[model samples]
Target: MGLERVIPVAEKLGVTRPEAKVLTVAGTNGKGSTTTTLAAILAAQGYQVGLYQSPHIYRFNERVKINGIEVDDQVLVEAFVRVDQARRDCQLSLSFFEATSLAAFLIFQQQQCDVWVLEVGLGGRLDVVNVIDPDVAVITNIGIDHVEWIGDTIEKIAFEKAGIIRPNIPVIFAGQQALPKAIQDKAQACQATLYAVNRDYFYQDADDGQHWNFASSGSTLRLPLGHLALDNIAAAIAAIQVSGLDVSEQALVTGIRNARLAGRFDVRQIAGKTVIFDAGHNPHGVEFLLKNLQKFMKNHDQYTEILSIFSMLGDKDINSVVKLLKGCILKWKIAELNVPRAASLAELNSALHTENNVEQFENIKAAFESALAEVKDNQIILVCGSFHTLEAIWECLEEWQ
Candidate 1:
């Protein structure tokens, strides 16, 4: 929860100050998307980009990447060895996350990347990724997810997220909602140039659905739509425009089109039926998922019914998520996740007590398999609630393949 332990170790490893241009992203939601887009755009512009994201969906190697390629196991082993030696020399014990993050930093430093796009693992102030000073800071949005670790209120969370802002750097508040006072205050205190979405820059879905428009003070780009959210992509563009990088319009276009992350409205076909794998565990994330779901339903009107293979962590606001999704999901196929933080079956039952058509399973695989067998031509299945939930289904799909 604090940087006291990791700072000395980072110093010992000689990665305290990054040689590459750094963009550190902190927010409750959209951090992955923003970082992905940032890395893609930079790489598209021919820069050697190092992207470090947290809580990889399938593999630990997914956490550290250079130009969209995950580093090999040997590379990770070598980096971890170096990090372990550094920690032992400093006579400090690093948490699993702290140790892994320091290893990513070491890899990026050694690889001599032109740019580093770092995503804050948890709250921004003391998170391991905040060890490096960023050339540009990006706050995707302030939401209520990590209340126990951050704070109960939005302002408090915003304050923690604002910790990534450095003096005189360009900070982008890409939240669609009104700016949080904590963020405004922190930016002012640091004298950082703040760019709030819909204030200093804006993005809107094009009527054609194939393109979106981004407009700032002087530039407007009609970009091709990609799988990720527009707001996050817009934040990436805003960061690059102020990053002093030599990115052109073509790079921005190519990057937005290229950026893709697993479990983020990831639509695919399985068993001749459509399935959307989304890792939206919180209310804010679910709202975004619903918006995209609604768009998909509108375009493909034949898909009349929506079913879900769902479960969540016990710490999350499961009731709120169920309430948001209940209106659209016709049938809920749920199971208790096989994780330490998984919600209990009793808790899942209680949250979904009001639902009319609900089916409970012993595990995520059975629930997903049931949905696959029963889904009709005019129906679609949505696998969501937690990344662990998606991982369960992914294991099943991989075995079948």
Candidate 2:
């Protein structure tokens, strides 16, 4: 639950500290994309990179990767053996996240990664990934999420997100909103150089909308857009530039073009239907998805109708998320997720509140199948609401393939 419990076991396993350059990223939404892009950039430059992320969409192996490839089962098994032995020696009970994070560190250490790109599993202060001090800490963005664990207010959440900043290390803030006072205070206390997105670095879509340009201080580069969010991609570039590493502009462009995460704005054509899978569970994340969807609609001929397969966790603000997308979503195919904290059909209906263009299914697979069966030409299907919703569809797609 706290560092006191996990740090001892990490030290016993020889992973309390890292020898590789560490870039720890923490945020409510863009952690996965940012970390993936960072790793791609570093790897493009020929550095052995280790990326550790959480809440894998398909397999547990997706949570750990070396040089853009998921670690093999034998690697994971070996790391787990060491972690289990260390935990037993320490006589401490580690949470699933803590134990897995230690295993990732062990793998990265044993592989002798040149750069370790880690995504904070939750709030930065007490999250298991914070056990290692980052050479350059990046806070992708902050929002009112995990209110129960972090805090109810934006300031409190930002405070927790800023916890990864160490004394005199460079800190990057890429949130859309203005800098929170909590982040300012923490940066000043740590004397970490702060780089706010708009003030210190900037990224803007080109007039053609095919490419984007990133500028920081006196240096600037035009790069091709990737499947991930351009803001997060730009932040990754900025983080690497500030890390004092030798990364060429060519490598930056290659990395951005190569960076792709499975669930974030993932678009595909299956059986001649356009389907988008986004893991935007909260209001802020949903807003980002809406923007991307609008752009997608603009690029293609306007669809006659937009159908959405949606479900969310019980703790999320379902009402707010549904409210945000109701205008664009012509019809809804709701499903009950199989997870413990999944929202029930009743909960989803109560949140809808008489919108009425809805059909309920027993599970996500059925809901997705129904959506696919009912699809007409020029109609788009959006599978979103939570990662679990997309995971079900992804598993189904894998099976079909």
lDDT of 1 at 386: 97
Error of 2 at 302 (Å): 4.7
TM-score of decoy 1? 0.98
Q: Which ten residues in a row have the lowest lDDT in candidate 1?
A: 392-401
Q: Using Cα atoms with residue i matched to residue i, what is each candidate's TM-score against the true structure?
A: 0.98, 0.98
What digit string (tens of lDDT, one per residue) describes model 2 on residues 103-207? 999999999999999999999999999999999999999899999999999999999999899999999999999899999999999999999999999999988
What clash count goes with each model?
Answer: 0, 0
C-alpha RMSD in Å of predicted model 2 compared with the true structure:
1.0
- The residue-by-residue lDDT of candidate 1 on 1-401, one tens digit each, is 99999999999999989879999999999999999999998999999999999889888899999999999999999999999999999999999999999999999999999999999999899899999999999999988998889999999999999999999999999997789999999999999999999899989989997999999997999999988999999999999999899999999889989999999999998877899999999999999999999989899999989999999999999999999999988999989999999999899989999998899999999998899889998999999999999989887786545
Task: Give Cα-based local distance difference scores for all models.
Answer: 0.93, 0.92
